[model samples]
Target: MDQNQIPYPGIAHTIKDKKALLARVRRIQGQVAALERALEQDSDCSAVLQQIAAIRGAVNGLMAQVLEGHLREHLGTEDQTPEERRDNLKQVLSVLRSYLK
Candidate 1:
């Protein structure tokens, strides 16, 4: 993972941990499906709320993992120029704004 396998820093760094990320995604998907099933079954409101919370937490965790990877690849890569690092920072800031909204 230290050696950049490709020029696309955004996702290239994830190659080393793709399996783990995919597994996290799968679990999130399962949580979402369970939430859907609960809705379909007219489950208790508290149960539904808890499921939604769990889904949100799982998604946030996944985002954190990918964002960490993206930062490490772009900001810490020795070959990257200052301009490139600034651009990466801007991209991250933009995404954070959107995510927070």
Candidate 2:
């Protein structure tokens, strides 16, 4: 989408959804705490692995959601000039490369 077609309200969009996002984060935190407790309690190896997998999935889901919003707000707009769009996309790609690593 171009800058003119920007569907999201940028940070305001995130702020509006902050409560829901925070709730998800809290749930993930709870899961992490549970994982810690399981380790402390000498849970079975398989159980610990399951907990780790759950945490990873949760984190990945969160990352995907945030990335979607960021792309929409920053790179998917039609308002920016072509040059600006290219620059923004490059920056986005750079961040993604670093993040993926």
Candidate 3:
């Protein structure tokens, strides 16, 4: 309930999504490390390009899941008061805008 941290949704809603995201990010990190090693080893261009493409696809998938979660849980209509709802919408928009950049 700290002012600096927004409340995350229920464990069932968030944990699974978070686990997936974390796994993808970890894979991306590994890919980046491999790419660096490839560069050090002077790897072939086609193999490097393939790994880069895979990393991009993984990042895009992660972003989609995060955006979907935001729309479903943070911005969805429910029983919130008007002011709270407006605040939620604002926060969601802010996050989306930041990510979209």
Candidate 4:
């Protein structure tokens, strides 16, 4: 499959949880803006590093949530046949493992 092509084009499951996800994203965005402002203002190094770490942790948490949703929605409980689900599981796991490294 082409790298540009998403296997699950629409996040049907995610749609139901969009508000929470979007809230998380907005928080991350706000953190990013704060980081930018800190840089512009020449904030203390320790404070900047703390902000960066917080952003990283927040992003990782968001990624984990999305990954769990993708697995559940596309592989584990999707309407596909068992064999198809297995294949998708393998593909998703492979990609996730690669990404985590």
Q: What are the models' TM-scores?
A: 0.87, 0.79, 0.68, 0.79
Worst 10 residues of 2 by lDDT: 1-10
Q: What local lDDT does model 1 show for residue 40?
A: 100
lDDT per residue as tens, model 1, 15-64:
88899999999999999999999999999999999999999999999999
Worst window of 10 by summed lDDT in candidate 1: 1-10
Point to the candidate with the largest lDDT: 1
lDDT of 2 at 52: 94
RMSD to the true structure for each prediction, in A, is 6.3, 6.5, 3.9, 2.6
lDDT per residue for candidate 2 within 55-78, as digits (tens), equals 888888887777787778767877
Model 1 Cα shift for residue 9 (angstroms) = 4.5
- Candidate 3 lDDT at 9 equals 45
Task: Give the per-residue Cα lDDT of candidate 2 at 63.
Answer: 74
TM-score of 3: 0.68
Error of 4 at 6 (Å): 5.8
Stronger candidate by lDDT (2 vs 4): 4
Q: Give the top-scoring candidate (TM-score).
A: 1
Q: Tell me the lDDT of candidate 4.
A: 0.84
Q: Worst lDDT window (10 residues) for model 3?
A: 4-13
Candidate 3 residue runs with Cα over 4 Å from true position: 1-12
For candidate 4, the per-residue lDDT at 35 reads 99
